[model samples]
Target: MADERLIAALDVSTRAEAEKLVTQLGERVGYYKVGMELFYALGGDIVTWLKGERKKVFLDLKLHDIPNTVGNGICSLLRLRPDILNVHTAGGLRMMKAAAEALHSAAAEADIPCPKLIGVTVLTSMDAEDWAGLGHTEPVADSVLRRAKLAQEAGLDGVVASPAETAEIRRACGEDFLIVTPGIRPAGVSHDDQRRVMTPAGAIRSGASQIVVGRAIYAAEDPRAAAEAVLKEMEAV
Candidate 1:
């Protein structure tokens, strides 16, 4: 089976580093997530490079700003034509809607397929206490649910959430909504900074459309073998 849903989080900081990992992982991974660290380091050309090599890109900058700025940011990023892009849901309905609309118009004008615009509900690194510290009385999952609802209403393709909340998000957003899960620790692996986590197979069973694996693969002794193991695990499901 073609496992297009497995996204490799290229969290490295240099073009050489990202290139080496992509070469090592080869065909086992189809999608690559370029987040702030690498994007800031290499700029958008890295996206162009990845596409040249025929790999899909997920530009996870999590853009959050005033409506107009975020809209322009989305329009600018659309030129790279990432397969997926994201914004912070905390920016609220106006910002999220602006991003979606911006992508729509830009892609239409450019004559390219618009990227799937997803909303970031809650970072897996933060738990309930973390949200409480931010002044929210509700638990983390509750807030994620509320945000997922708002994301759908804002015309977002879906949300980036932890595996623990994938089921609830799916229930709230319905089957077609995309659920991209990060903070995945293959059973018994250390959770690191992420507080909410699930195994690869567990996340798939929970209705996650895709899952992001960072250290689990990047920090492994053999990144190719590590990626293959993750794909095998997903295949078992």
Candidate 2:
């Protein structure tokens, strides 16, 4: 896309389906997110294809594991050279630090741009009710902010957070920290499974560095037009 702030999610389940969305949207969308659905199915095949097409990739594996294991996993991803990569903040300070160190050193050694490392704070699907079911008493916003701070302290580039928390995250993490908000449902659009939702304009005005839209575009009858409408909404901000 002409605007660098919007990311179109390739949330399909197959390579053929993923490519269809890519071809359909074409040049209007320059950045695409490869989440677990398509990525686990096709592995790096789709990433390579996107690279061939000169589109930026957000490899949303949300890696979380032991410090050494996570570091090694990130090292292994050096080959795809995704534009941005998300790791889980729930992995703790050591794990996040190790992953950041591994990515930075590996990228410097390989002479490539170290993919922007973002922390997954909290899933947008979880609301206060769902969070309580997880057995914690803390408010979701408090936990999300805490994790965002932890991510910053651990040297992550930013976080994948909800738009509802975007402004607070910006205030806490500062202007440079990348805030990639999902759960974006424009007005008159279904929120789907997203519990904390905001419109594209609201997300942008809330200070999101990037917003990810999936069903709103990919699920529409005409994805290109849907994406164009989204861009227009974003541009109006």
Query: Each model's TM-score, in the order given?
Result: 0.98, 0.98
What residue runs in model 2 are displaced by over 4 Å at the alpha carbon? none
Compare the candidates by lDDT and give the number of the best one. Answer: 2
Clash list (residue pairs), candidate 1: none
For candidate 2, write residues 1-237 as lDDT tens digits.
Answer: 267798999999998898899999988999999999988999998999998999999999999999999999998987997999989999999999999999999999999889999999999999999999999799999999999999999999999999999999999999999999999987888998999999999999999999999999999999999999999999998
lDDT of each: 0.93, 0.94
lDDT by residue (1-237, candidate 1, tens digit) is 337889999999999999999999987788999999999999999999999999999999999999999999999998897999999999999999998998899999999998999999999999878879999988899899999999999999999999999998888789999999999988767999999999999999999999999999998889988888888899899
TM-score of 2: 0.98
